[model samples]
Target: MRAHHLALLFLAACGSDKDPFAGGADAPPREDGGVIGDGSTTVDAAPRMCAAKPSRVVVLGDSITACSVIGGPNTADCVSKKVADYVMAQHGATAYQNHAVGGAKLSGIAAQLNAIQPAPGPALVILYIGGNDLSPFIFQSDQQAMQGYQMIEPMLVSVYAAVFAKLKNTTTFPDGAVLLTNTQYSPFDDCTASPYNLSATKTGLLHKFNNKVKSIADAQGADAIVVDQHPAYLGHGHHYNVTMCPHYAAGQTPWMQDTIHANVAGNVGLAAVMNGGVDRLYRDCIQ
Candidate 1:
C-alpha cells in the first residue's frame, strides 16, 4: 500500500512486457492490475456471511476474463458479462467487478487482489491466468520453454496462495467464498495446427501446469474449484477438421479468433463452463 511498494509492484510485473497470450484492447495490457495506470486504488470493507446466492462476483486475470475480442469492445460477449448477466437473471441481486487486465500474468494479480473490497455475503472470484506466463516461451525451443515454465510455476503458486489466504478466511468471506480457477486452454489444437505447432515437450507443460493448478486448489479445500478448460477447448481450436483432429465433429467451429484469444462463441463456452461449476458445486446457496 505504500508508494514505494506500489512502484515495486509495477517493476516486478513488467518482466514479459505486453500480455503475450490474450492480446487485444482489454485496456492497454496493464500488468500492474490498473493500480496507478488506471487510477484504481485499494478498498477496505467488512466481511459478511453468504446469502442464499453470492451477493458479489469478482473476476480477475487476463484478457480472457475481460473477454477481449479481436476488433470489438473488450466486454462484448465476454465471459464475465455472461456470468454477471446469468447471476442477475437467476438471483436478481449481485454486484459484479472485473479487474482483469489484458496482458496480465500471475504477478499482476497481487495488485488486483489487493484492490478487492469484500462486501456482505459470500462472493465468487473467478481467475484465469498462466497463459501469459507460458505464451512467451512458445516460440522458444522445447528445453527453453520448459525452463520458462519452471521459472513461472513458482509465481503461480505464490499468487494462488495469496488469493486463497486473503479471500478464503472468515474475515474476508464469512461463510467461505467460491474461488474459481482454471487450466490454460490451447488454441493450437494439440499442435496439429499450422504456424503455431507446439512441440510435444511444450504441450506436455500444459498438462503439468494444469495439474499444479488442481493440486493447489485441492490443497485449499472445497472453497476452491479448478475448472479444467484444456480438455473442454480441444476440439474447438483452429484445426477442428477430421484430418487435423480426430475428435472433430459436425457443427464445430474455431472458438478462438486468433492463436491466443477466444472469440465470441468461445467466451460463451467459457461462461458456460463456469456457470456449470456454480450450479453443481454451489447448488445449496444458489437455485
Candidate 2:
C-alpha cells in the first residue's frame, strides 16, 4: 500500500478482520538469498521454456483465480476447469493450484499470497486484482457514496502499491515471469439514481490504475502483461458473468450476449490472451 495507508491498515488486521499476513506466514527464503517485501530483484532475461521436468503452476488472484462461485480452478464443473484444461493440453506434466477467493479485496490478496506456495518450477505467477477495491460496499446515499470513493481510492491504491511492491521483486518464481495484470471489465448497468452505480467511471479508472501497476512492474523490472478483458467481455449492454458465477441466463452468456463472462468459448479466449500476452512482458512487444 502507499506509505500512509500502510500505516493505518498494517496493524491489527490484514483481511477478514484478522491480522491475516502475520509473520511466519511469509514464503520460505529464496535460494537467491533475496529478502521479502524489499524491491531489489530484477529479472532481465527473456522468456524461457517451461522446465524439462514436470511443473506446478500457481495462480494468485481474486475470485478469478480461485474459480469462485465457480469451483476452484480444476475442481469438478468449475469455470476454471476450462483454464486448467487448456494449460494441461500443452503441458502434460502440468499441475496447478488456484488461491483466488471471491470478495478478496486488496487486503485479502496480501493475506492469501502469504499462504500460497512459492512458485515450484518454471513458474508463471498470474496476478489480477483491484476491481473489488474499486468497488465500494454499497452506499446508502449519494453523499455517502462520494465520501466512500474518496476515502477508499488512496487506501486501495496504497494497498495496491504495497501488494505490488511485495510481489514485484518476488522471491517466488525466481526463474520466470511474474506477470502483473488487472481485472477485465465489460459493461455494467448504469446507476441511474445512485452515484454508487458508477460502473463506467470504474471502467475508465481501470485503465489508469493498470498503468500505475505497470509502473510498479517497471520499477521492479518485471513483465507488465496487459490482458485486456474488455473487448471479449462485451455483451449486449456490457455486463460480465457475475464475478464467480457460472449460471448466466439464456440471454447473458457470451453466446447469448456476446460479452457476459466466458462461457466455454469466452474462457478459452481468455486463456489465449494470457498465453501469448505475457510473452510480451518478458520477451517482445510490437508497436
Candidate 3:
C-alpha cells in the first residue's frame, strides 16, 4: 500500500450494528416504528414469485467485494457474502460462491467470470469491480487522469459487454440468471482532504464510468440491474455530512474502513442496496 493509503488505513476503526438482513414475524420493528421490510415485501401488486430468484449467488470483484479492510479482511463480513446469505435465506437458494480476489482489476474480474462454468438452476451474479482500476487516477494530474480514463473507457465497455453476454448465455445459466452489477462509491464524497485529496476531475470520471455501467446494464434488458452504490453511499464517506450531498441526512459517521474499503457497517448498507435491487426485481416479476 502507498504511504497515504497506509495512513488512512491506520485511521480507520470498525464498528458494529444490528443485522439489517434479519426479518419476518420475529424480526424487530424499525426505530421509526415501521416494520422492517425484508427483501420479501408483502405489498399488494407485488409478485410473490420470481423466476430470477437464484438457486445460487456468485460474486466477482476486487477487495471491496472480497471484504478486505484496514485490519485483516473477513470474507463473511463483506457485502457480497451478506447478500449471498440473504438470498439463500429469503429466496431458497442452496449455495453461494465468491470468486473475488483482493486488488483484482476489471481484467481480473473478466478472468474470474470466464472461469465459472454452467451450473444447474438460476444464479445471480453480483459484480463489484473497477474501483481499483480508477483509484490511481485520483492521484494523477488532470491531463493524465483524463487520458487514463479515455484509455480505460473502451476496455470497460468491451469487457462488460463480453461478461454480460456470457452471463446470460444458456450454457452458463442453464435455467436462467440475473446480473446485479454495482456502481462505485466515492469515499471522499467530493470533499477533498489531506491524504488522497480527491479531485473534481477524478469524481467526474467516476460518474462517467458509472454512467457507462448504467448504460450497459440498461442495454442488457430487465434481467440485468445496476445497483447504484454511489448515490446510496453518498453521506457515508470522509465528508459524512448530509450537507455534502442531498441524498441522505447530514453528520453521519463514515462507513469506510479506509480511503476505499467499506467497514462492516458499510458492507451492511451495501448488502441492503443489493437486496433492494432484488426486491424490485421480485416486484416486477422478472423471470
Candidate 4:
C-alpha cells in the first residue's frame, strides 16, 4: 500500500471527521464482489476481513443484525456474510454467533443474549439495534407511539445496561467490545415519507437516543462503538417508508435492499466504518 493509503487506513481508525462515504471520484468496482461508497479509489482488503489476530464475536440486536436473508437474497453483512468470514480468516480460528431477532424489543434482546451460546474466547459483541423499537416512537403520530419513543429512552438504557451487565458477568465478553450503531438516517425524506420518517422532532428524538447510549456506556464504564458519525452517511439522514426499510420491511425484491437497508455494498462500507470507528472509540474509552 502507498503511504497515502496507509494514512487513509490509519485515519479511518482514528479520525471522526474523515467520511468514507465521501467518495474520491466514483471509482470503479473491485474484483472482490462488494460495493464501495463510490466506485472511485483503488480497492484493497475489506476492513471486515481479517489481517490481524482474529477475535470471536457475537452480534445481538434487532432485524438489522438478525434476519440474514430475504427469500434467496442475503442481507446481514457485518457478521453473517463477509465481515465475520474475514475476521475468522484474519484471526485464525474465531468463533462467531448471532443472537439478534427481528422485531424484538430491548427486553427481547436481553433474553436472547442470555439464551445464546456464550462467547468461546476473547470476543467482541456487535449490538446493532434501535431501528425498529425507536422508529415507532420516531414516526408515530398517535400519542401512544410518539410518547413510546420518549419512554423508550429508559427502556433503551435498561437494555444496554442489562446487556453490558450480562456480558461483564459472563466470560464470553472478556476484553470484548460492543459495536453500537445509532438510529436511522437515510436518503429518503421522513417528513415527506407519506407518514413522516423524521421531522425536526424525530431528529431531536434520535439525538437524545444517541446521547442516552453514550450515557449508558459512561455510567457502566463499558466499551462501545458510537456511530453518531454523520448524517451524510445515512443517505443524508433522510427517512423513507417503513416497507422500504431493509431492516424491517418486506420489500419486493433483493434490489429493494439497497432502496431500504444497507445493500451488500453499503454494509461492507458500514463494516469498514464500523471496524475502524469502533476500534477508535474503544481505544478512546479505555484512555
Local distance difference test, each candidate: 0.59, 0.43, 0.62, 0.43
Best by lDDT: 3
Order by lDDT, highest first: 3, 1, 4, 2
Error of 3 at 76 (Å): 3.7
- Candidate 3 residue 38 Cα shift, in angstroms, is 14
lDDT of 3 at 280: 60
TM-score of 2: 0.56
Candidate 2: clashing pairs of residues: 1-158, 1-159, 1-162, 2-158, 187-238, 234-259, 235-259, 241-261
lDDT of 4 by residue, 1-287 (tens): 01110011111011123221212233333322121122222123233221123266666776556644332113445434444655565445366677777666666886777775644455566676655554433223534544455455556666776776666665645444444444333434223343323344444444444444443443332244344322324432223234453333333212225334545554554455444433433221223
Model 3 lDDT, residue 41, Cα: 35
Candidate 2's C-alpha runs over 4 A off are 1-54, 75-81, 84-93, 137-146, 155-177, 189-221, 236-265, 279-287
Using Cα atoms with residue i matched to residue i, what is each candidate's TM-score against the true structure?
A: 0.75, 0.56, 0.76, 0.60
Q: Which one wins by lDDT: 2 or 3?
A: 3
Candidate 1: tens digits of C-alpha lDDT, residues 1-287: 01110111111121333321222332233221111100111011111123346777888987778665533223558888787777767755368888887777778999988788757787888887756665555445555655555567567767887888878667666755778776666565565445544455545555555556665664553466556666667778776764656457777877876656778888777777667555434442222
- Which residue pairs in candidate 3 collide? 242-250
Across residues 1-287, which tens digit of lDDT does each residue of candidate 3 receive? 22212111111111212222222332433221111122233222333235466788888877777775633233667787778877788787888887877777777867887778779998888887765565565445666656666655555666777776777789888888877787666676655554555555556656656556665665554457667776667778766754644344645767877656788888887788788766666444535
